[model samples]
Target chain A: MDSTVTTATNESVWGGGNQPLGASYGKLMMWFFLVSDALTFSGFLASYGFSRFKFIETWPIAELVFTHVPFFHGDYPLYYVAFMTFILIMSSVTMVLAVDAGHKMQQTRVIWYLFLTIIGGAIFVGSQAWEWSTFIRGDYGALETKGGRILQFVKADTGERAALADFAKNIPSEREDLQRDKGLWFQSEGYLTSRSVDEVVEGFVANPNILIRTETINDDNHKTVLTREESLKRIKDAAHVVEGANLIHNEYGSRLFADFFFFITGFHGFHVFSGVMINIIIFFNVILGTYERRGHYEMVEKIGLYWHFVDLVWVFVFTFFYLV
Target chain B: MAHAHKLEIFRGLLKFKTNVQKIWAVLVFLTIVTTIEVALGIIKPQALTHSHFLGMKVLNWIFITLTLVKAYYIAWDFMHLRDEKNSLRRAIVWTPIFLVLYLIFILLFEADYIYNVFKFGFVKWNF
Candidate 1:
């Protein structure tokens, strides 16, 4: 039995020690979790790359499509997203400092650094929300045709985008007088009078020249755009242009890109949020002298691993979502 | 009096108090590198734009190189990988390096294949 036990011990890796790497159980678990998380994020990014390849052409240019605002209607490129990335990276720096302070048993410093990290994370989340809202609202709205294709207008002169509202004119309401009472015989019932599909189709067909195609319009300059004379004539006949995004095409951008962007970034934002919460908990513990009592700041080091993992994820996300 | 002298000697030898200063210097260097990356990305020199190395655009190569540098500092210094033993360090670093490289190779090849299909295949996505 003794010989067998000796052989087993010799065969074991890491000098037969159970506690290899000298890492605490918690830290080891964190490493494992991070590895798995890394794989999960890589899967999402790979899928995105594959889809991008599958739709290489006709896919929207990310920079051009993403530029828009609610109040300001003009061209603003990659600056906003770049700033958000900087914010997240800076937050990671603060987190590292906080962990360092914890190791030194400097409770006050830890508190301050952790607070800064939390603030940075909150700002990032807010910026992501703004980005999502802008994406959902769209900038230069595209026309969704019956064939499920998006047709966007570009300025003929400057190649800037033209909004849907630029080409669409409002049609005056044609409300009929409501009849409260009818002398027709039987029990009175609610009146039902509406334009049926066939009627609407007939109305549209009656004015073939008025049905303006979106492709006929072009952006002319930074400020004002122009619609082709033929398109203008068609619009004069048709009365109104179609107004929002639809199943075939999104006004904001490509539906698939938007969907993937939201899913990936939203997931990452959730991770940042949870990381902040964990940091806060660790912050309180540091202040309460928990690590000081334990004679080491290994807990801080462990949390540092988690914080750095979040930073690493953001780096990849920034590259794929913005730069690439 | 003897114990006090020994304590002073211990502090002198360990230099434990100055780790923070070293860390701050490293952090400053990292900030500079990141700023450089952003600047390069924005400027995108004409020479670099047209040049290709290793089947990738020069700009992409630059970005990857700088990113690796940043990763090095973040892992080796910030995460204290440098302080770890050889086996422990290898376990942490080599695993990720090997796995990520393998993944990139497979994915890039797959992407190129798909691009070829789109270029030559029967299906016409463009209207």
Candidate 2:
């Protein structure tokens, strides 16, 4: 009877069915999804490379632009980002250990490892939020001129950041209610009255203390920020001084590069968030002995694939975004 | 008895019981290497900056080399690629190798071309 059963199974195993890619159905689907996701990421990164190429001359240096931190300011270059990378890498390690525990049928071990992985992921996401906030709230603000150029200001003595109000000769005394409407149309909910271009220029001309200069009018080597005296000499230089990094133009740093950096890293952060959720579900299952009763922990292996993919993407991200 | 010998051989090769210890060792090594890389990157000595290798900066080469080493350990030990069949291993590894190389080559070359255009183009980017 056993021999007959073995023969029957052998015939079915050799039979030509429309099986996918010589892999199990689940693994095949996972591969297909990964391929599409990879293409999407590639498209974003390629567009970034193209934009970087287009603005090759005045692109922001990655190290200098992302160097600042809150409270502990002054040239803290790449340290925080490196720490974030380590957190993600360590999470990947925990994920692998979880999978190994699952393979050994050690349910408690799986739970502990998964728990650690989730914590690591949460920390990474938090770090990313801090990074984004630092970027949006720029250290130095600049004024946008009519010709789409950015004009930035600095202190005369210490060369620290000078506020936009410091450059204003006549600070607008009449507080215009942004919500007040001239016509029948109601004002926009989020509308705020920003200082106008003419107002900025008038303020600059009026205030003898505030100096206006373009970003490109640096000293010969372009390594150091221009001094107030040097800035006065190069005022006629046709460089746009812009305040902060934005989608349209980044005067505080490289505009195109910043756009790509946010988009790519933001997508990866979304992936980490999803991975954490999946790991949570798996963690609960491990605690309940669901896999123990089922005789194997293949679920852990599947999720491990996803966790590793996140780590792999981060490896590339660290290289391009930070190291390069 | 013969099957028991085969089992012992497998156990010896895998070192399954000590896998956890090995994982910790790899993690510690990776941390040390990363710290060293960051230190070197921050210091960025003048001599290293002046040197070039294979049309790239020496510092960049060091980064690439260290990254490859990290990748090797991650793939081989953590992912158990070392225990897998050579064909399966190559299939997984070679694809990324070729793709990444192609991407770096095209992007860097185009970047240099664009740099040239900016340096000599009639249209000034700053203007």
Candidate 3:
């Protein structure tokens, strides 16, 4: 015990000294903060798991839901998401490289690596925004039953997904557009769907090749497709036409699935946004030679920890949300 | 602070001379794992999907395992947790691990119970 205190106190405040964990206070605090952040994410994922389990038979299959790429029109399941995963992982690599260069006081190398990391983060955030827009504007429209169930369409001959536009016939109706100035000034109606429920039902009766695919999953793990008569019977129960996903309704499948998808991914995207902002600030600091003057690049290392933590959370998110 | 990097991965089976080389190696490893995950997810082999273990699909088990492997490499190597002292590593890693497992177990079990209620009982599925 070092009893070298010259004041009235004879013993060291810390048992041995400061940094018993062999880490700086700032680094240790950062680690603790990450731990707490990890738990917050875990709570979200666990709730997601709960909802999935509760609706295990009716939960939407991720491959069918997220098959669209930015420009492509074909079915490419998990492709863009995989691309996003690779981008995040690559950015993590660049961040660690920057930290390594910082260790050696290579200011230029650190700056360049940080620049790459920033670009990677920007690309990821942009991709996420595109994904959210696509999810909001769903591809194939579906019918929402009175019980809040989704009924999609499939071609009877090909067993492939069929869009509502492929079969619905335009039927003129007497329904008036409810605008504020037109009628019911204080009671404006919701956005009217292009095709009404009556038109969809009328189209279904005309198209013999279309079948209704209900939300129920059979023993084969495929959605339960109703026969011709059953499809005719089920169409009468539909109350609304769901075009895309939102907090209330999802054309894909269960409303909970879309809710969790938006909340978890949105929260993660926010994290990436903040991480990019932090990285940019650090990039400017490096350019200004702040660390060089300080004789260490610990600031870069601290931010690197945060960047890697984001990647780590994405790894789990990719697994549970997309893969599992 | 020029700390010496512990450059070996995969239980010391592979070693790198420089930190940069090790970073690339880990990247390749993560990429391969992710590729396998994506491929399996897309194909969804019938045999694996049909089989159930621990009341969950075997395919999901594989995905979760691979995800854990990726998480391990990212945390231990990229975050430099491996180089951190034991106390700090445990403080950051163990707490979440224990709590998350417990939370998942409880929530999943409760969810399964609710699912059964909706399935067998008179209570109907409203949404």
User: Among all windows of ten consecutive residues in candidate 1 chain A, which has the lowest summed lDDT?
Assistant: A215-224
Off by over 4 Å in 1: A1-18, A68-74, A145-149, A171-249, B1-17
- Computed on C-alphas against the true complex, the DockQ of each candidate is 0.16, 0.23, 0.62
TM-scores of the models, in the order given: 0.73, 0.79, 0.95
Model 2, CA-based lDDT: 0.66
lDDT of 3 by residue, B1-127 (tens): 2297899999999998998999999999999999999999998999999999999999999999999999999999999887876667787788999999999999999999999999999986643
* lDDT per residue (tens digit) for residues A1-324 in model 2: 312122234446666543322334554455456546655676666666666665543555566568875568588887988898899889988987887787678888889999999999999989988888788666666765444545576665665556666664454555554554553476555423245444555665555566544545232313245555665444444234445565776656556676787789999999998999998998888899898998888777677767777776776677667775
- Give the candidate number with the greatest TM-score: 3
Expressed as tens digits, the lDDT of each residue in A237-313 for candidate 1 is 32112233333346443456766787798889899889878888887887788888887777777778887777777
lDDT of 1 at B83: 57
For residues B1-127, write the lDDT of model 1, one tens digit per residue: 0001111111245332355655665566666766776676556677875677876568767777766777676666556656554556676777777787777678867977887786799865432
Span of ten consecutive residues with least summed lDDT in model 3 chain A: A1-10
